[model samples]
Target: MKVAGRCGEGSEGMVRVARGPRSAAMPHLVRGMHRVLLALTACGVVAFAGPARADELTGTLKKIHDDGVVVLGVREASIPFSYFDGKRTVGYSQAIAMQIVDEIRKTLGMTQLRVHEITVTSSNRTPMLLNNQIDLECGSTTHTVERENVAAFSDSFFQYAVRMITRKNSGITDFRDLAGKPVVTTAGTSDERLLRSLNTEKQLNMRIMSARDHQEAFSAMKDGRAVAFVMDEPIVYGFKATDPHPDDFIVTGTPLGYEVYACMFRKGDESFRALVNRVIVRSQTSGDAERLYRQWFTQPIPPRGINVNFPLSEQNRALFAHPNDHALD
Candidate 1:
């Protein structure tokens, strides 16, 4: 399957809950009313339905309304997408999450809506979201069929490919070159799954290691713990560029897979998902997302002035031009 993030909005399956009580099951109630309305409309008896009222708010929105707080799942280090830039969480995804928060404030008319950032790793992010410990995650998470089976996702904002970073003298040109070599990827990421599958399917017998995060994976390669660091192309490039000896490493290899990234949340929060998608769709169509891409990928970024220099790909251009939640997988 390709890296499957969408450019448009989509709601797929079941969700966990928010950190608080969602006593107001407005979505279910609305669906029940919708059934009746559809039946009536078929008979030409009822033709109109109005918007939900304040008290009818449900799911994350309802939780936010009641609690006045929006919990955002943030990555401590995903680089350029989402990471702790020393003092705070900042990145392309972080900016998008903030936009969602702004819209949430407007939607609820709550001028004092507080944003709570919780650091999440690749493994725990989903569980935290499912358990209602966090509200939504906007990071470098790949939108996949497996993930959609449990959670909901916003429109696709970014697409990427699986690649690897290796030392220049390592002479690793592509996937085949890494055969029988020690390779590392972040634990719980799609890249790890892809690498393992490659090892098994091709019988490469590659010694695979899993780090907790991107930084750790990079460190593995830097410290000679692994011959290669595998991850998304841009992320590996980000790390390579930022390293003290930028020329010592290179991001190479035929992509193992293609995937898209999106904001994720509980499975059935229609209102909240809509709000998040609006922000994303707005950014794509308005050229805001592209600018952010240039800021993070092509330009120099924080703590150091390293320029990743990854240009936008044709697939992403198509995604931005025609936004949709179509999973590539």
Candidate 2:
């Protein structure tokens, strides 16, 4: 039986089915097989039948066409990374997502692809990818060794160091310096994983609080419910800029670690992955990538409660300097 679901932007559309029939007369066994095939297709496991045609698209490309659009998962709350500019969306992540759509169109010999917006929080983004609910995620997601088990990452889109935000008097100087202090982070982010690992490996007594999203985590710290907020360096800077009492808080902590952010897909989609990589590469070479960054991160993100000046840290500069290659390590 045919099925339709609301993908990005709360829009109704049909998703790709590998073998489902348009009629309900199809047997349950066949439908089961169809689901399996769809899963395979979503992951790019099986190549489409017949000769590979430049005009014929499969996996994400086929889904994009069937839906008559591209569904991009993004966090409207994430500034610099992914967020809206009034009615229109703008950010480093959205810009890269658009580039990926262009590459998919070129690969399929199509002139256009529709863009659909999907709202996702930290907890559900990765799961959404595995279930085929999100064609591509434009939110800031870190690449980690353990996460690679289930998700395929595009070329490194951004990079930042993991740092801590605490009340100015809390006195946390560095990561290794936070021995027994409690730390807070959004649930399902690589920051949570990194903090936990450091706690164990360093043999330090650390209590960690998990928030459903970054906004929540920041609120906890602002309200003095938590001692510190741990996250990527850019996020910390953004928060500092918007805090009502910026001087009341201080962001300190040795670099616990570094992370590379990338767009995500279901694992095993080599063809789709390659297409995404090419798009970022093309954007970088064309100079559009730099322009997008300047437009988003450099601009004031008032309601987002954060603002970072143009040009990111020198440490994470390579993501902007070069493009198109995976930055997992």
Candidate 3:
């Protein structure tokens, strides 16, 4: 699983977590691999049931497949991943999506496979995939056990660690230090779930508030409605760069948990999921993953702010080395 190329180096070491919520025990990993194999076998056994005519689709993916197009659903808010690029959407995830679609067409021997962008809200993302409105979602989504029930996720292309963001003078040093203090997090996000679980399980006694989006959450921290905002480290760094007063905010707290950011598709569509996973593996093996990351995350911000090069943590490096090859069945 060793990838070729230098593979962007320069970060402190961190432990890699299982992308899916399974035991690190060898037996579980083996079982998971078996399940994926079985699922893919099932997909192979099924008849295509597609059109008799050349390049025509007769089933669920008719509109896009027949038209030789790949529809991607993305969040307009998530930065450094999928965000507005002028009138179009672009980012690391977007670049990965483009490569995936291109590979899909080539691998499947299709003459042309166009890419169509679809905007999706947090709540509608899963539903959109279930209904086949989007073939893939190339946004920053955490791969958690609950989410796995409805959708299949590709091997995580990126790793993120949870952290807290607050004003430099807020005096919040860690999760336990926020007793009775309000923290703003996006609604229906892993950040909200993690914080609430901490309060209950660890008896942290923190007051939590939810915002409709990341912008609102950050605004709450800036306006004093909330003492801090909780999210992954990279996300906080991305937003911190765009802050009107960059020195005003500070990122604090020990890493809570590791998150595996990956592309997602419907649970039952093994062929489609495998197609996306193949692209991810190729990207990592070819040094494209690290290159794309530097382009978006390390490069200088446009209009304002300085270049903030995010160092590659050891955990991510290991993920690139021994990725769960059976991410998609």
Candidate 4:
């Protein structure tokens, strides 16, 4: 996919390997034994004989076990989802990603595991995952059929409505009012695609402008370069809360689209995917997910003491009740 915006900067890309006293050669020894077992099985020497070894883990888990490290892709300013709080990355997604890391430690029976963090943008997150540059992407990424062709998503963790943020008196109350008005959307985001499609399908004659990121998109709206900033509802709220004049803008208009947010990783990794889905499902059923949602959405968070104040929607409550990876269109 072609991403239009400049990616976020200032990621620590921290590489943390758990310190341990285990023999340095243990990983190598395990790998050697794994190869020998595979060879024997392939040669039919052990076919249908003896207990089968657990299916060799592939993708993220395999890489983590081999290298003793896992990489997580994060966002720099996605706020409440994934963002930098001072020098540390903190948000709802960050917390969940750590939970997955803990599960990996248990699954591999490893006393220590390393973690590496990398910053990813809307355009680069999927490509980084596909290239194995990152084992998992924990950011504000929407899952769509087109993205599914290149990567797989975990169970939906959050849902959003695509909406518009404009000055309170802009007279843009709905999609019909957007005709012939300049609108800004972050580059490489679903909002951009939705606006383009609306323009084509409904002949709205909207003048679309792409911003490098949400901050830039909001700047355009503030400076009168664009009459409206179009993006996911949570994100719009995030920006509005942080703006100096929070009361100046309003998120209005009927939703142009609905989005399901989930963590993304490489395709064809069923073992890894299943592990991720299990973690999400367990969190949902145990009420851990709801707690995290409340922490970020209802309560005040760091850097700024602003609360997004978004109550969990009924659609999302249903998703948590019965977690599944299926996309909600």
TM-scores for the candidates? 0.83, 0.75, 0.78, 0.81
Please tell me which predicted candidate would have the highest TM-score against the true structure. Answer: 1
TM-score of 1: 0.83
Per-residue lDDT for 256-288 in model 4, tens only?
Answer: 889889999888887787678767876886678
Instruction: Write down the RMSD of candidate 2 (Cα, Å).
Output: 13.0
Mind giving the per-residue lDDT tens digits that candidate 1 earns over 1-329?
11122222342111122244444755888855655554443222443423335797999989878888999999987888898878899888898899889878867878788999999999899999999999999998888888899899888999888999999999899999888889999999888998999999999999999998889889999999999999989888888777789999988999998999999999978878767876776678667889988998888788676788889999998888667676666
For model 2, name the residue pairs that clash: 9-117, 174-253, 174-254, 175-253, 175-254
* lDDT per model vs. reference: 0.82, 0.72, 0.72, 0.81
lDDT of 3 at 77: 56
Who wins the lDDT comparison? 1
Local lDDT at 176 for model 1: 92
At residue 42, what lDDT does model 1 achieve?
Answer: 26
- lDDT score, residue 66, model 3? 62
| Global lDDT of model 3 | 0.72
For candidate 4, list the clashing residue pairs, or say none. Answer: none
Candidate 3's error at 138, in angstroms?
1.4
**Between candidates 1 and 4, the TM-score winner:** 1
lDDT of 3 by residue, 1-329 (tens): 12122212431111122355656565977875655544433233224522234445333244455667778997775766787745678778888888887766654466566777899866678889888888789787778877888888888888878898898987888988888888888887787888898889988777889888777888898899999899878878777877767788888899788788888887766556656766776567556677787787888744353454577778777777665533221
Which ranges of candidate 4 are over 4 A from the true structure? 1-55
Better of 1 and 2 by TM-score: 1
lDDT of 4: 0.81
